[model samples]
Target chain A: MAVVTSRRGRRTAAPYAFLAPAVLLFSLFILLPVGYTAYLSLRKVQVKGLGLGRGARSEVFAGLENYQRAIADSQLWSGALRVLLYGLLLLPIMLGLALLFALLLDRPRVGLRRFSRISIFMPYAVPAVIASMLWGFLYLPAMSPLNYVLDKLGLPEPNLLSPGSVLFSIVNIAVWGGVGFNMIILYTSLRAISPEIYESARIDGCSELQIALRIKIPLLIPAIVMTTVFSLIVTVQVFSEPLTVRSLTTSVTSTWTPLMKVYRDAFAADDLYSAAATSILLAAITLVLSFGFLRFVQRRAFGEDR
Target chain B: MTSTPARRPRPAFLPTAILLIGAVYCLLPVAWVVAASTKAGSTLFTSFTFAPSGSFFDNMGDLSDYGGGIYWRWMINTALYAGLGAALSAGLSGLSGYTLAKYRFTGRSVIFNVLLAGVLVPGIVLAIPQYLMLAKVGLTNTYWSVLLPSIVSPYGIYLARIYAAAAVPDTVVEAARVDGASEFRIFRTVALPMMVPGMITVFLVQFVAIWNNFLLPFIMLADDKKFPVTLGLYTLLNRGATEPALYSLVITGALLSMIPLVAVFLALQRYWRVDLLSGAVKA
Candidate 1:
């Protein structure tokens, strides 16, 4: 009894010991960086005069100056607005198609379901950089089969990577890469639903369409919302696709998105203060959107928000 | 069997057709890459876009010969980063998650919540700060910069905690303790084997995530030699714009990068059956 109790006492320390590595890493990487960014955001390089010599430009505290510039910056506003519009386009269609394909895949006896499912999910395997590169070449007029077909048919060829249409073009790449994973998540949930529910509903004279609308779609709400929140997060952090395609076309400016502006400020313009401020603000926005959506979802009586 | 004419035989044709359309849309770009990769540099634009050619081997040769096989180095670098990073991330997540799951500790929920909050912070927001922090330590532009930052995945931990709770039973730990085995030994010998499926799932998710990720590596490393395949190919693509010859190499490099990831996807997909990631939340 004495030995057992002593061993039990010793085991109590084990949990904290097990958690040490993760805690250390999280602190070193996530926590410390976030804190450093907050610190950096509060400081600026004070130029003494011409900013030529080592002593000329000194690092000094500049409370909220960086934040003020970030807020007032037109590029940041346009980038945020563009991302908002991009998210609007991406979330609906991507989730909609994902939901539709998932529901269709769930239908019994749907032909080529396996083939369709794998093909759709295949893009999820392709990295965003490579996916955009592949699609980038396809968007080129000389290589685009769309243009080739349009040329043969004498229809107007659309410039997909143009400044005006580039948002949708980027959205297309996102949707292509995103829809499959979301579809699989939904489809998995759909598969978990017992067929007895469908059987009982079918006995009540519900058609297949009605059954999907009333049963599958309604039942998959939690899954849909989960995927949407995820997509929203990813869409906001949209970097790889736009950055890759920027090389293919001049339409995308260096500051095409808020994140891009942050990158440009930090690296190109040598303004780490502004970049840090923008980064924190962006993180705050993301946290708000995430938590806000969760709250909204909870308010709407979501079963799993807590 | 109760059959009804009222229920028009669920037309398999329409569903199949709609699905086929989506599949085509998804595969068209990949198909274009495959065809485009076969063309020699001069004939790349001259020939029809979809027309098949015989220069795939030639382009592969060029890619291998370029920069003293730096393309191959990127491939090795990618495997190192993703493989080592994911393995460590999964291990740490597993240990932490299992601790959070099976143990009653002070600030357990607080720690879990704090870690979960990390998932919501977008990669862009974190990338610059991480870059700056690493630069301070003079670790920037080094492999450790990318690998170290990626080793901590909040999502992996969340999934691990869920898996440990769902799969690794408390009774097993107790049983192991009664046998006079150490706590660490029990975790290694008893709880971990049961959590194998979950660990693999976590590892695969992190692997793909790190592999597919561009911004972190792009910001961290300026040296092309240290670049992952994605960044290397991006720079190659950038150069392709001014120099058309590099385009063929870019096309071939893009195709080569897809193979390993797609192979891993095909091989490990069966393990995703449990989906402990999202399964945690569903009631």
Candidate 2:
């Protein structure tokens, strides 16, 4: 009985022993930081007499004041609206191309399937910084092959980096980098479908396009929802691409995106309190958007909780 | 097998054309970078895009000579960060995921749910407070600031949990236990081997993620010596604004930085399509 009890005790502690490191790391990094952000967001700085020395400045609690300020900040609202615009422009076009390419690749007897798949998915390996930089130069009128070809054709050249068109240029860079990854995801899911289903559909006199439209697209909704949510979260952040492009042109501002605004407020403006508030706001919006989207899609598509 | 005839279908023209167009759109930038990296600084803007030049080695030499070869330092730093960070992350994820999947323990679902919640939090929210917290401890600019945050990947652990549940069987563990194997020993010898393929997928995914991470390193490290390739190239591009000559170097550096990743991607091509949630690859 003593031996059996000892063995049972050891078994009980085994999982915690294995999980110790992950739990510790998660607490230190994820849990602590989020709690600290919430704490900082509720606090404001108080300046004492003369405001000149170490103890002269101190943190004081200001309930919801920072949130109020964040709500009223025109720059942040504008940044949010701009990101909304960017997402509106980016999601449909990028996901459209991804779905198109994925369907084409999954087509029967498709030529150059391997080459096309590899070439299309290759950009997933390139970092956003590099992708933006590469496309930034390509958008340069003097160095652009597009402009050169237009010149030869006696057509007017478009200035891709100009303020009026820089957003479109950014969109192009994003599409170039993102379409391949999304295509691969969609294609992988497409490949998961049993071929027997397709064969039966074909035997029923359905064309390939009709099968894709009727069967494949309908079955791909869950994957499409997932990709859409992930892309939304990423697109809202919108940091590296625009940050990289800002070096090449003046169109992208220091606070081009909400995340960039958080950076500016935290480091440049030395406003950690407000930055913390903005960070919390952005995170709240992200969570709401993602979970809201997931719930809506799940209810509509599956009629049950995932 | 069914007794249906295996007839060869005719090649589809329209589908192939659309796929080819996508291939071109995706490959055009990579092709441009390969060509642009070879041009001399003076003619970088003047030369026709996609025209290869003889200054390939010269541009590389200039990149090598720039700032006492800090580009190589950035490369090593990136490799170290990605390599070591991903290794440690994979190990932790494997242990925790295996334990979570196999053991019936108190507070298990709560813990897993909390960790999954970490995945939904925007990185900016974490990055800002992490920077401040690190600063409070006087470790903001250290290698740890970046590597520590990267180590606890929720997504990796999630994948690992799914893999362990699928790959590691209870009967094998029961057999090992009956043989009087210690828990850790049973895990190391009996279960870990089965989890290796899944762990490799986790390792590769985390590796690329850490390598391609820009915001964390950008926010944390101010020292040029410690900057990863992404941040380093970004700064070089910023400087290129003042001196157009450095644009060629940025171009060269970008091209050089992609080689290791592209090589790894090609070598491990089979693992790229592993579905993290299901831990299955139809291929």
Candidate 3:
């Protein structure tokens, strides 16, 4: 009996053993890099004459200098503000459209539901760089259909890549690429709702819109909150769209977004210390914002259980 | 009781129309790309925007012949990266998620929370640090630079955990154990088959994530030969702004890049059971 019990104990340990690879990989790749970034954020280089040889430029421990520099950098601040503006333009519009499409698909008698869903969701497959490239060309005054129509009607053409219009251009690309996936997520959650709830509401003479507003949307709060948080997180990391757009327009400077600024500092300006500090600062701000947002949503949406 | 039923409220036409309008807005850029790819270089700017010419095939041929088939090479590299990376990611996520879900192990919550924290660490914040670390090991600009990082997906593990908890029953695992089967044997033979659909979902999600990835590949690789399609197209577009002649090739390349992914998405449409909140709730 002791031998059999020992054998059982040995067998049960296998799952944990199998899991070791994933945990090890996560530590080495994810945690170590993050910690290394934090560490690098606190250090800088001390240069000697000409700043040109290996030993001439020695590593020095600079405490908070990089952080102070990052805080004072107007370019970085403007980039963050630009992303905020872009998010302001993007989040409500994208989530609103996603919820609207989801509710529409849930309603009966909608013509061509499958076709529209597939067509709308198709863009999510395209990468942001490619999507921006496609839209960038379409936004060109010479190639755009809108411009063509305006010209035919003898009307003025709008420049999408103009300095004032560039933020909206970037936001529009994000909304186009994002709305469909969020729609599918919300739609899937909508489908998970038991039909009995809606049937009883119908029996009570509630209209479809009433049912949707009071029942469907309320029940979809969890999904909505999840999608919103993810959208916010992704919006904070906006890099590829503006980067691709920058290639086509001079108005999009290298420091158009915080991440873009970090890239430029690290790779273009060769200021790794400043870039590391800026990245760590961005990560801290994102953590505080997201956690704060999550707390607010949980209190308001999920109440005590969450 | 036999009387005609009272009239029901008609569906809200305004909101539905507004939603469809939004859908059109979402689809407009894609439609424009299709139309733009068909125009010749001379006609691209001169012709009416919606008019189709017969230059798509010619542009593709020219793009293929440029720099001895560099565009095709990008496509192949993208496929390899996304395909292999997703496969390995799915395997690791499956194993880890299964263990977390089924076993009553110590430090489970600690381990799981640590992994979940990774989901919140935005990719951009990690990219610069990851690049610097890779530079130390002389691994930058290599395939490993991209592939190594791509294989560890916290979100994938999260999804797989939810799937394992919901899909795999404890009773079956107990039964396999009672029959003298090893834990690994039971997982391989019993749990894995039950988890196939879930694993496929994880694989598709990871594949799309990896394929659509730009910043990582952009930072890690500098060699044009190793560039993925997205980076390669960006460089082409950058050059096109100056040369103007490369415009048609850029358009053609963009169109071609959409085909493989669109095909994969359509084929996997039925399997994408995206229960975003349910996954978190289950955890």
Best by lDDT: 2
Which tens-of-lDDT digit does each residue in B161-274 have in candidate 3? Answer: 778888889999888888988788988999998888778878888998998889899999999999999889888888887889898898889989999988987787676556
Best by DockQ: 2
Rank order (by DockQ, best first): 2, 1, 3
TM-score of 1: 0.94
lDDT of 2 at A84: 90
Per-residue alpha-carbon lDDT of model 1 for A1-306, expressed as tens digits?
122223467776787789888989898888878888889999998888788977998899999999999999999999999999999999999999998898888876577778899999899888899999998888888778888889889999999888888888899999999999898889888888889999988889997789999888888887777788888888888888899999999999999998888899999998889999998999888888788655543344323324
Error of 1 at A257 (Å): 0.5
Clashes of each: 0, 0, 0
Q: Candidate 2 chain A: worst 10 consecutive residues by lDDT? A: A297-306
* Two-way lDDT contest, 2 vs 3, winner: 2
Model 2: how far is A66 from its true place, Å?
A: 0.9
Off by over 4 Å in 3: A1-7, A49-54, A292-306, B1-16, B276-283
Candidate 1 chain A weakest lDDT stretch, 10 residues: A297-306
If scored against the real structure, what TM-score would every candidate get?
Answer: 0.94, 0.94, 0.93
| Regions of model 1 farther than 4 Å from truth | A1-7, A293-306, B1-11, B280-283
Give the distance in Å from residue B108's predicted Cα in candidate 1 to where it truly belongs. Answer: 0.6
Docking class of 3: acceptable
